[model samples]
Target: MPTAISASVAPQTGAEPRSPGPVSHPAQGKTTEAGGGNPSGIYSAILSRNFPIIGVKEKTFEQLHKKCLEKKVLYLDPEFPPDETSLFYSQKFPIQFVWKRPPEICENPRFIIGGANRTDICQGDLGDCWFLAAIACLTLNERLLFRVIPHDQSFTENYAGIFHFQFWRYGDWVDVVIDDCLPTYNNQLVFTKSNHRNEFWSALLEKAYAKLHGSYEALKGGNTTEAMEDFTGGVTEFFEIKDAPRDMYKIMRKAIERGSLMGCSIDTIVPVQYETRMACGLVRGHAYSVTGLEEALFKGEKVKLVRLRNPWGQVEWNGSWSDGWKDWSFVDKDERARLQHQVTEDGEFWMSYEDFIFHFTKLEICNLTADALESDKLQTWTVSVNEGRWVRGCSAGGCRNFPDTFWTNPQYRLKLLEEDDDPDDSEVICSFLVALMQKNRRKDRKLGANLFTIGFAIYEVPKEMHGNKQHLQKDFFLYNASKARSKTYINMREVSQRFRLPPSEYVIVPSTYEPHQEGEFILRVFSEKRNLSEEAENTISVDRPVPQPGNTNWESEEQQQFRNIFKQIAGDEMEICADELKNVLNTLVKKDQDLKMQGFTLESCRSMIALMDTDGSGRLNLQEFHHLWKKIKAWQKIFKCYDTNHSGTINSYEMRNAVNDAGFHLNSQLYDIITMRYADKHMNIDFDSFICCFVRLEGMFRAFHAFDKDGDGVIKLNVLEWLQLTMYA
Candidate 1:
């Protein structure tokens, strides 16, 4: 299998939060019309590179639900693993395959056990506690659960022994279909299970997700936010408990009120070691879902409380506010009734705010931007996403310490129109989130590439520095660490930093942690206002003259003779290679007086060869060679313009003027770097050095132009291509 490398950069924090416009749903069936030709559509959100807008659509659960009913067959995925070991299940646990609907399994099996409550999910043998925790948190909202697992699905109504579930993969919703076949040991589920034996939603949902990724093994270990995003088409921001925002408590309260799903995990990561119950009653390295947050009066004093669930359906925290702890005794019956307090071994437990913070090390909150409730619909934030890549020899110039070519990588220019409308605040604020994610690492963990350290730099583009400036000046980031507005540089799979910036145009440069490392990335930009659009650089294309057509009447006798000689030496071929061109040059040098006087040597002939081979094939066809011949003639004019003394070389002081005349813009530092690399021992640029410098400049020019797909002289990337990564496959 070919190894794949990819990444995503999403800048999310921005100006004052504003109410977004009404969300639009794509017209069904016509895949091309989804998102309405707008790449920034919210539900159909996928900005991509290379793929067309129509490529994002997939069969909806409703569509597949109807199809399975008509076909009268269970949805047996052709690629489903044949047996247990095929999906890497442990040999000690022999799994017996069973294909049956809910009625056959039990007297009254439910598609959704107990109204999609958190207690309905119970983790079994699988190590996918992170995913189960996400599901538990997702159960908090009935509207949200119905949106994820369509209400139309049930064993009796649409029972063909097939079920379909929808997940937001990258920028679009994808339907995954699976049969009711499950792994059973001793006639019971061997993996994820629910409290009631008749409840099978958790098992079936897990199976659908497993099939979506490749197998159950592929879903073994991962972050909860990844699963939450898939279930809710939400934007997630991860926070470390130690460095959480000052307003974190308020953020958590608002998140729960907004129906956002959250999960937390302890610090330790001991592989394959499962502790049925820790000494503190909180399992280390195990993920727990946050179900509720509230502040209420208890015994004439106000106390903050948080509710959490351990997917195992049994373990409870032994500290204060725990299930049977003494803290509950202090609360009177009325207050207990008001808070809906309960003490049970159903895995759900309450903890004080202080204890919650101290015990959990990391938290993941999925913002649920796409599927926000109708009440919060107007509060949705519009997101603009851009996708990019870092090829080793091309854009992967890496970090800034490599001064020479760091500026050559792709750069995005974002224009912030307005600051947050905070009436009392004197400081202007711009909030945006920057998420840098490595692609395909999760899917091909065993056989494919691993994650790489990645981050991005944001620089302010002064108002005067508008139009035609493709990149920041060489010294723009050199003077101080404060030059770039971003708070700090972090290397992680996906770092979503929310930043505030006064109204200004900013440049974002995404890169690998080290210099010259290659990977592909997607950069997403979100703000309160829709004023954000990439600034396109207008570059002047080189206009080298083409050779006059043959058989023209207005040709001098000498010119006609030379043209005839050129055709005769070239024969049937349209152009010539280096060796063939050398032969032609040799013939011209012997016959032409001007060539003899100029003293052009074989080194010059080789420089010309290096100049014309654009495809790097070391061969030039007719059109390529003609462009080279005309460009060489043009360079001779530039050489004479700078070499006023009529010497064979131009002075070092005059090289910049000569290059600029040839249409290449080099900053002072790049100018110094290039001259040092190519200048002779005498520090003088001979005709050879001059042509070589021009060739290098031309290559840069072409590299920048390659990204301007529509000939609009600007770089635009698709956001969907970056988010999907390997998730789409």
Candidate 2:
């Protein structure tokens, strides 16, 4: 059994700072100058819709297949180490960290530890990145990591330890693996020099390209447009930033705190102090986080701390918002320089939180969880078979019983039966019963009832040998609460041959079977007074063939041909016979002189009736007759096959021969009885019975088929009367 973890954390309410009111900034009119062409229109539309897209290039199926053959590994940066200890070591190594937008943080961390207890690969795709990251984070947890991977030899013998990364490619998620390390400075694997020595980085890039667009060439010179496609499922809509706000870090932090991934901008008319420098120009960029804002300040004075991350990670505001712009000339040069601390190019910046909310699009969150439980509060009953099998016709004492009700604790009852045995053959017929009871305080009185019932039966069988010698053996019967009124009988005869069975402890343990319906029935097993539902009667027939194979009586060629012809006439119908066709084909065959005349000839009648016999018995059952006559118009071959003997006219001899060929071997008395029973005033038996009788191999089958007058295939009322008057009478 596996456990599901909740994805989101509950909101914290104690001592959290209140949200700030909206404020207007002075630098609101500046246009973005970083990118040559302005995409403000597209950006505005995207902001209004609030749909995030992962811009990645599409690749042909053929190319993707080719790339799958190449093996690659993604080198992960040390900053995101396997565990807390590794994290400390990686950071101490002075590795440049590959940072992303702050709003992307989630409560459920991914990542687990690897050891004898746990070792397996996990995947992350679509909006489940948070869950995947959580899994990755969990790798640091002790034995908790091994829970996901089953500990078995199946995993050790094969390359089963691989985890896959799926991103929407073309139309569905394409699998990709972590291949190589990102760029690194010093011993770190992030923000290294462009000329850094690393074939692994190139390999990773190649693998990424292969996963995205199928070829390294396609990935070679593509700009951010192509990269976005490869990353996200759709294209990116760039936007221009006019006069952006200062304090972007605060804005980024605030967005993250609010669980939002949006950014903002401001067009200011006057110079505003941002960080330690004054900014007063058109600025354009994406917002990442929001920190804080000064509220209820003087009407003329206002400031906010906002943080932003550039997807590219290198660009910054160079105008009035730049670290050392002249708008802050009122401050000393050295002091201004101090305020202009270097903002890492890694897609992070500071701006007004308000502006950040207005400019960037927020990605949607999608997480799901499901839960299931087993109950102990159920009601049940035991079903006992005394003299015969569950089906009607079988040897005596081959009884099978089960609980008549559904049981919540069905497994417990089954266990008890599996353990019990008996010595005396007569007393071996008894076993144990168990019931699981649970308290339910529901309004309904019955709702608080017991849950399940299980029982076990002990029985014996006799074995006879040469010289009239006989021995008695003992066995057990088991029943469960899950399946009502069902008990499995184990014969002592079978047990003796399989294992030594003589004497053992015998205990009538109590059991319970849960009821499927609401009702009451007689209680047979447990002595406890409880309302037990009656078990539904299920008629199960078991077909037992003799152990010997290839013992069926052989049929002659003529018989085979007759059987084939009969089947062809029946086609797809069920219970086809003269009794079935009486209302339809009977009237038609009677009214149409041509049909009667044709039928008068044995060959023609056989041709028409042969198609009605489906089972190759040379006889047409009611079902087969009904189906054949219904579609007689569609049967073009019927007339040809039934018209045997090639004579122009059919006589009594031909009719008798056709019947004989079809496998009917009745004596004159039986034939006359059947004929008179199914014949009309014209002295001709109806086509339904005519065809039905041909395939009937035994006298009993013929009698049974004749007794069913309504042509439903089953004998109904008056069956005995009809048989007495038509045959023995």
- Indicate which candidate wins on lDDT: 1
User: Per-residue lDDT for 90-171 in model 2, tens only?
Assistant: 1233334342211122222122112311012111111111122122222222222222221221211322112223343332
lDDT of 1 by residue, 1-729 (tens): 111122111111000011121211000000000001111222232211122111114544445556767987665445564465335532334445654445666787767644666776777766677778778877766555655565556776767666666676665666666767777655777678878888788888888788776667666655666677677767677676778888888998888767778887665433233333567798765668887787867778888988888777888898977878886778877877766678789888888988988877677777766445535544566576666666543355566756544665567777777777678878987666655555555555446444555667777776788544555544666653422432333333354667777778778877665555656666667676654755223244554346776863525664455456667766777556656776665565356333213444555555566556666666666557656655766776788776667666775545655666787755434555665666665556776567667765665456446656687767654787434321211
Q: lDDT (0-100) at residue 290 of candidate 1?
A: 83
Q: Model 2, which residues run further than 4 Å from truth?
A: 1-255, 258-302, 319-347, 354-622, 625-729
Best-fitting candidate, scored by TM-score? 1
Local distance difference test, per candidate?
A: 0.61, 0.27
What is the overall TM-score of model 2 with all chains considered together? 0.24
lDDT of 2 at 168: 31
- Given candidate 2, what's the lDDT at residue 428? 29
